[model samples]
Target: MKKSPLYLSILSVFLIAAPFILTARYTQHVLIVVLLYVALGSAWNILGGFAGQLSLGHAAFFGIGAYTAAIIASKTAFSPWWALIAGPAAVLPVALLVGWICFRLRGPYFTLATIAVGEVVRLIALNWTTLTGGAVGVVIRPSLLSGTSKLPYYYVVLVIAVVTVTLCHLMSRRKLGYYLMAIREDEETAESIGIDTTSYKLRALALSAALTAMAGAFYANYFLFVDTTTVLPLALSVEIVLIAIIGGLGTVAGPVLGAVLLKLSSEIFRNEFAQANLLIYGALLVLVILFMPDGLMGGFRRLFGVGARKSQRVSA
Candidate 1:
C-alpha cells in the first residue's frame, strides 16, 4: 500500500477537533488514555523495536518518573511540571545502570535481566515507606488544569504522543535508527560492520528510558496519584510490550494503533465481562498474537498489501 500523509493529516485534525466532536467526558478520558499508552508504547519501541532489545522492565523507569514528580510535588514547593524534565532526567542514571548491566547479556538473558531489575524496583517502592509511601502510594498535587477542564490534560498528553511518534520517525530516518535496526537484526554483523553495537544500544536505551519516564510523570500528575502496583507492576511492563507488538514492531504507527485497539478492547471487556475480564483479556491477546504476529499494522499492510514498491514508504 502506498503511504500517504493524507491519512495522518486527517487523523491529526480529527484528534485536535475531538473535544468539539465528542464532548462527553468519558470519551475524552478514553482517548486520553489511548494517547498516553501510545506515548508509552512508542518509548518502549525505541529499544524494543529498532534496537531489537525487548525490555520488559520499562515499568521501573515509569514508576520512578511518577514517584519523582509526585514526591517533589507533595513534599516540596516545586511544580509537578518539573517532572517533565526531572522525570526523564532522573531516569538517565537508572537507564545507564540498567543498560550497563543488561547490555552485558544478550537475547533472553537481557530480557530476563530487565524483568528482574523491574521486580526489584517494584519491591523497593512497595517497602520503602519513607520515599514512595510504601503500598499506600502517593497522591500528587494536581496539575493546574486538574479541575478546570479535561481538555487541557487531553491536549498535553496528545502533544506528548505526537512528539513521541515524531521523534521515533525522525530517529528511524537517521543513522542511529539504522544502527539500532542493524543491532537488532544481527548484533554480530552490526559490530562486524563497525557499528559499535553496545554504544548504539546504550544510546537507544537512554532515549527510550527518558521518553518512558516523561510519560510516567505525565500519568502521575494527570491522575493526581501514583502507586507501586499501578505504576511499577510487571503487568504494566508487559502491557507496554503488547501495545507495541500488537500494533506493529519497528514502525512508527504500530504503538498508536496498538494502543487504540488494546485500550478499546480492554474497556469493552471490563465493562461487558466484569466477572471474566481477565479470561477474556487473555484470550484476546492470544488471538491477536496468533493471527497478527507482526501486529495489527502489519496485518493491515498484508491485507491491503502495504509495502514499498519503490522503497518502504516513509509515510505510514
Candidate 2:
C-alpha cells in the first residue's frame, strides 16, 4: 500500500535531470517555484493537515527565516550558505512562542491567532527600517550561486523539497503521526485517551516551522534579496494552504502534485489569458473545491477504488 519509495525515487531522478533536459531558463524557473512550494506546502501539512491546526499565517515563520539569512549575510562576512542552519535556528524559538500562546485556543480562534501573529511580524519588518531595511529590503551582498542559469537554485530547492517530503513520509509512519492524526480526528477523545494534544501540536508546529524556514532561507539565497512584501505576505500563506488542500491534505505527494498543477497552470494562464488570468485561476480553484472537496488525490482514490484499504487502516 505504501508506494512512496518507488514514487519518490522516480521523482528524484526526474528532478535531478530536469535542468539538463529542459534547458530553458523559464522552464527551470517554474520547476524551482514548484519545488519551493512543495517544501512550503508539505511543511504546512504537518501542522494544518496532520495536526488539524489550520494556520493562515505561516508566512510569519517564512519571513523570519528569510530575514535571518538576509540579515546575517548583510552584517557578517560568513557565506550565505550558513543561513540553511541559522534561519531555522532563529525561527524555532519564535515558532515555539507563537505556538505556546496560540495553542491555548482551539479551532477558529487558534487560526485567528496565527493570522494576527503573522501580520504583527510583517508590520514589525515593514516599520523597522533599521534592521530589515524597511521597504527597500535587504540584499544579499554575496549570492550563493552567481549567474542567470538558475540551475544551481533548482538543485538547492530540490534538495529542500526532497528532505521535507521524506521527513513527512517518515513521520506519518511513526507514533507522532498517529498522535497528530488522533488529535485531528477528535481532540476530546484524544485527550480522554491520555494524549497530550497541546504537546503534540507544539511539536508538529515546531517541525513545520523549521522546514518552512528552510524554504524561506532558500528563497532569500536564490533571489539574493529579502523583504516583507516578498516573504511575509498573507497571500503566500494562503497559496501554501491551497497547494496542500488542492493536491490532497494529510498526504506526502499532495503538495508536490498541487504545486506542479497550480504553478504550471498559472504560468499557462498568464501566457494565454494575459489580463484575465487571475480571474480564471480563482474560478478554477473554486471549481476544484466544489467538485472535489477532498482534493485530487481523494478524487483519484474514489474513482479508481484504489488505496481504500490503506485509507481505512489509517483512519481507524
Candidate 3:
C-alpha cells in the first residue's frame, strides 16, 4: 500500500509519454488498441471474474454504446466528445434491464441468455437500416476526430483505460468486490450470510456495462466507423473474456498484462503466419489454458515461489 502511489505515478508518467516515445504510427495505433482492450477486459472482469456471471454478450452493451454515439453524431453536428459520457449513460438502463432478466438464471444458463441477448442486439443493428444504417454501417464525418494523427485517440483511450482499471482496483477492495467474489465462490453460502447476491451482481454488471460502453464509443471514434459486425461480434466478447482469464481473474493488473500479450501475439501471428494464424492463435490459447489454468499471474506466482511463501506464512 505504501508503494502504490509511487508505482502509479511512474505508470502515469510512462503512459503520458508513450505516444511521444513510440514515434512510429503503427506502434501508437497498436498501443491505443491495447489500451482499449485493457479497459474492456477490466470492465468484463467486474462481473465475469469477480461475480462469476459469465456474459457471452457484453458485445451487446459495447455495440449499443458505439451505436448511440455514432447515431447521435451522424444526426447532429455536435462534437464527438459527448460520447465519452452519453455512450455509457445510454447503456446503464439497458444493463440494469438485462441483469434483472438474466440474473434469474444460474451458471451456463445465464451465459446462454447473454449470448442470445447479444445476437438479438446484433440482428437489430443489422436490419434496422433507417436508424443504424443497417448492414451498410455508419461512417463518421471528418468533423468527428478533427485530425489524421493517432495521438488524440491514443490519449483518450489511455485515460479511459486508466480510469477503468482504477475503478476496478478500488471496487475489488471495497464491500462490493467482497460480495461479488463471495457470490463467485458460492452463491448459496453468500446468500446464507445475508449478502444480496442478485443486487451485487446487478451492480457489477452495471459498472461493467458502462465501462465497456465507453470503450465502444472510443472504438467508433478511433476507427471512424461503426457496424454490427465490427462492434457487436461474439468474437470480440470472447476476446474480452480471454483477456481477463488469460491475464488473471480477480486481479487488477491481470487484464493489462493479458491485453498486451494477446494483442501483440495476434499481431505477430498475423504477420508471420498469415495463412495459419488462426490455427496457431487457437493453439497458443489452448496451451496457456492447459498449462496455467489460473492464467499468467498464477504461473508467475508459482514460478517465483510467491504461493509457497504465502502458504508458509499462513502455516506459521
TM-score of each: 0.95, 0.95, 0.94
Please say which candidate is ahead in lDDT: 2 or 3: 2
User: Candidate 3, residues 5-122: lDDT per residue as tens digits?
Assistant: 5777898899999989999998898899899999999999999988899999999989998998788778887766678799999999989999999999999999999999899989
| By lDDT: ranked, best first | 1, 2, 3
Q: Which stretches of candidate 2 lie over 4 Å from their true place?
A: 1-6, 309-316
Which ten-residue region of model 3 has the weakest summed lDDT?
307-316
In candidate 1, what are the lDDT values of residues 214-306, reduced to their tens digit? 999889988888998789999999999999999888888889889998998898888888989889888988998999888887788778876
Candidate 1 clashing pairs, residues 3+ apart or interchain: 1-305, 1-306
Give lDDT tens digits, candidate 2, residues 225-313: 89989999999999999999998888777787888889889999999999999998999899888887888777778888887525324
Reference-based lDDT, residue 256, model 1: 86
Residue 206, candidate 2: alpha-carbon lDDT? 96
